[model samples]
Target: MSRDCTDYRDIFLNDRPMMDARAPIEFAHGAFPGVVNLPLMNDREREQVGTCYKQHGQQAAIALGERLVSAEVREQRIQGWVEFARAHPDGYLYCFRGGLRSQIVQQWIKEEGGIDYPRVGGGYKAMRTFLLETIDHAVAECDMVLLGGMTGTGKTELLVQLSNGLDLEGHANHRGSSFGKRATGQPTNIDFENRLAVDVLKKRVGGIQQFVLEDESRVVGSCALPLPLYRGMQVAPMVWLEDSLEQRVERILQDYVINLHAEFVAVHGEQGFALYAERLIASLNNIQRRLGGERHQRMFLQMEEALVEQARSGSVEQFRDWISVLLREYYDPMYAFQREKKGGRIEFAGERGAVLEYLRERVNQRV
Candidate 1:
């Protein structure tokens, strides 16, 4: 075999494990799912090499890089590559452009470790381009639906139950609302886009000619939707989810207050509640201008008192007061306006089970 794989669709569809040979900063900015960064050069070393290349030429930079990663450092890096190669025999490795850096790694792995591990042809740049194209292609070719609902009508909950459902919020690691932030920070925009592209590609490859996505703003948290997909969503058919106000309140309580606090506790351990309280207060404060001073202060007081009560007595009952008010006064009206605007596109409107059944049937109709 040539051992230089360029089949981007198959690579992503199979969820192939990948070793990213880019610098740490490069990987941090964006990388595919199931990829592990095992950089041939750290950020400092890569910077030094880039400077040398610009000042002295390619030969001089190559000499400098060899000098920088000699002996002990070279052996250590090779050892990691060997371990990864042994573990994922079918996996591939790549640098930013499948050029000198990856070739060097491949050569070293063979010379030192007696393994002929394959490298991804054209590397990260090419794979990323393929994924971007995947999203655009799906936007052009596939039948898409947008699931919309008032706050806490369980749109996301119903979305996950379908084979063709595309959970945009899950991919963005955000809930797509003011209180949507999680304990951990979101991925970089590039990372989020890459993840979403891979998902669309894999689903399409699995024979899904249609996809059901949440009706989202152009931006989800800090991650912006691909322009093609966003534009498609603008004209796509919509399914409006509905629920009783009492049920919506309970769902919000579980997802935003109880579950979100537990998530913070899990991530931050001893300081979880403190950080969770700060996040909640900050989230509310973010909307202070819109909520107006009087309403904001009233809700803020309710939130603060609720937080205090929860801290002291583990009583979350008080949180319902603020959550219900915010839903009724803030979220409901805004979403009602959205529903009216999207009324022409609303193909079906129903409660959770009904909406889920309709979406499933829509997906089936496309088959």
Candidate 2:
């Protein structure tokens, strides 16, 4: 029987069972949800076949592959497929392009008097096409909202607390900061997009009328945000977090100090600690030497001293007040310009806890 099939769109959306016959690595990066991996060839063998194909052409590659696929090996693979098929009786199978790999497996099943194993029409490529097309359509239609703030205003924390919305940063396993690399390592761009797509699908299913996301640059580490999603975020409504410097610094230290210290040491070592201590001093020195050295240095020294005291005290209220003053004198003006440039459709400015609560209420009302 012909093994030609078209696509897995109906199967995936309708929850029809499916299995993948691609190698583990291919499936690892991205695969249709619920699709089981029943690879026809293992990693080393696949690589060897590819090398042969490149060096000696398709006929030679096929001959070498056939030699490699001993009867015993084929039986072992067929047995595994039989077990999987028995477990998922209605399951269909697919390979790279509804091609040889899938045909080999499907034919084996039929010969064994197993259940019919229809191949996905275009196989993995078709599924990928559907994912890309669906993602593009969703991006155009979805209402995206950006959650923007300075370094440590609990933007990510608040994103988690929000009852309604998607958490792109969390999905990426990143904090959306300069120091946001995951301890578990980052996902590939395709993996990241696949995760994002799954999140979007879940939100849509849950009746999410709009998405809330952080205002991020186009790239997050090695992963690039899709153009459509990025554009939606750019034009979407925004909520800027405004927190006092003392609060901001305290929050930053709390978020970063424990989780990031090892990474910082790896990157900057002992010198990093000294630099951390002297950053304000260095900035003050530069200002004093050029613009208004004396006054700037004095202010810097005071701020530096206050920071040290706050660190020593570990008092949340004290840190909050300190960050509040810093925001008024320092972070506010800088953020003002950025907000004006952003010109977001909506703006909610206040303390982190209060702002998040208000935003959550608003989102709930809308929903």
Candidate 3:
């Protein structure tokens, strides 16, 4: 008796391992979570077959593919599948669609004395459909509360501190900035979204009333937010955080020291002192422009000097003060304008810890 392909969906939702028989490039675009790539054809070979199909027709392409994959090569591929299946007996497999490639692989596995592995019903296309549908459903049902604030109000820190809520940036292993990629490298979009969906689903199952997320543009690094989620965030109630310039700057400096110290040293070398000073000045240059002309240049140079002194002395306080001053004079006013435009919907404002405690209390009261 033949096993049903539809059962693969259950396997996927359960976080069981799976394999993609499509080319690597195809898998990279999007794939189910936990799906390993064991392509029947590599990128170049896939490209050649595609070209043949377009130019010489399907028959020619099929013939060429057969010639390319000899019996011994096919056996070796089957052996690899056998090993993986032995390791994960309940594993799932997929291809571009429930097409010839997957059927061939599936038959080979069964013939090789490997346990029957379920194939995705409609293959990767079906999985993609499911993911998009799930995202849409989540967007519709949840109340999204965006955590909006100036650069260093400890928004990310507060999210981490919260026992409830999704941390999209943390899951991405990014700070959601130009300088946010991990030293290891970023995950593929499929992988990132898979992790995000799993986290969100878990929270929803645990009866989370609302998701607390940082205010981010549609795209974070290379990954794009689902359109529905982004749209919902735009209209949702926003909790803006405010802090004293002294506190905010101290927080920013501490974050850099804790998170990016090694990265800074790696990029700038042992005498990273001068390099960090320059970077700080460059960061303040944007604010300097708002300050205008000679005043901008003066503040710019002063901030640079302060940073240099701090770096030399191994004291971040002075540099933090310098940035706090810039933020007070520059970024805060912009934030004020935005807040006024947002009007009464700005539900709360205070230090991160205080705001989180207040929100948690309010939520508990409602419960």
Candidate 4:
């Protein structure tokens, strides 16, 4: 039945659904996109089996696992696998190493359901290695351009416009700033790397050898950039994006205040506005050390006032005051310092239109 598939590239490139048979803890620690964990053994069972193996060796441990699972428990798990296999006929199942655990599941599925379901030949570890190699290879071989700008300059917006753009913030589910967190939390670091690697692989597969990426530090909110891409970004030619302070402030108002408030509302419903207000306050507090005591207190008071006005009148106009001050007095200077440091790598500098045109030309030039 050709039940072991080893085509890692095809599986990822096609966004194939996958069933992960590792313990729940393992799946939570690291997993690819579109993967569901239907573990062969739950955490407790796996732990017991492991302890038994250490004490009594493999055969005894296997016997203990079988007894722990019993017939009824085994049938329940097999039924879940049967349902998943039927639901995703094209999907493959895997364990940490495609070892005894995955083999046992395959044999059970066939014996109980008379169905031949495939498993990933080398499983999760092998697939992770492949993704890491993908990122490393792209870093070494691809031509990449970085979009640099002050806060609120809409660097992310520009990146999305390019067909070859790699939106790291988008992949990380963050805004890449002190205020970048979304209503939902960021993915695990392993999940973040897996997603980033998959994105680069699919883009490269689509003939995008040249990529446009936002200039960012190693860490974006909670997700860190893969080391290879971070190193590449340090020396990559940069297109600096510029905007008037008034315009930048307005953009930040939209992204951090207006849009973010709505996002919180959508996610949390009745509790949304309160959570939104809390998030804003927390975001402000995050930079307190840098903002200094007096300035931070002032900014904090202004933010509290703005949130009151927003909650009362449903108007976000008040946010512009704090947003503008932070950008001018805080984010602007920091970004400016970074710009000066990376001055030699700056190939072009202009407002959005000019920068977009310049970046597009860079991609076309490669073509």
What would the TM-scores of all predictions be? 0.98, 0.69, 0.81, 0.98
Per-residue lDDT tens digits of candidate 3, residues 1-367? 1354665435545787887899989888766656789988878888998999999998899899888888998778888887887888767777887677787778878888556766777887776666676667788976677788887787888887665667778766677753354444467777777677766666666777667888888887777777888888889888888777667777766655434555667766785555555555555564455678776776666666666666567655555555565567766787778778776677887777778887677557653
Q: Give the candidate order by descending TM-score.
A: 1, 4, 3, 2
Instruction: Give lDDT for model 1.
Output: 0.92
TM-score of 2: 0.69
Whole-structure CA lDDT of model 2? 0.69
Of candidate 1, the 10-residue stretch with the lowest lDDT total is 358-367
Residue-level lDDT of model 1, residues 212-327, one tens digit each, is 99999999999999999999999999989999999999999999999999999999999999999999999999999999999999999999999999999999999999999999
Off by over 4 Å in 1: none
What is candidate 4's TM-score against the reference? 0.98
List candidate 3 stretches off by more than 4 Å. Answer: 1-4, 7-9, 55-59, 70-73, 178-184, 188-191, 263-322, 365-367
Q: Rate the local accuracy (lDDT) of all candidates.
A: 0.92, 0.69, 0.72, 0.91
Question: Where is the poorest 10-residue window by lDDT in model 4?
Answer: 358-367
Q: Is 2 or 4 the stronger prediction by TM-score?
A: 4
Question: What is the Å distance of residue 206 in model 2 from its true position?
Answer: 3.2
lDDT of 4 by residue, 93-135 (tens): 9999988899888888888887799999999999999999999
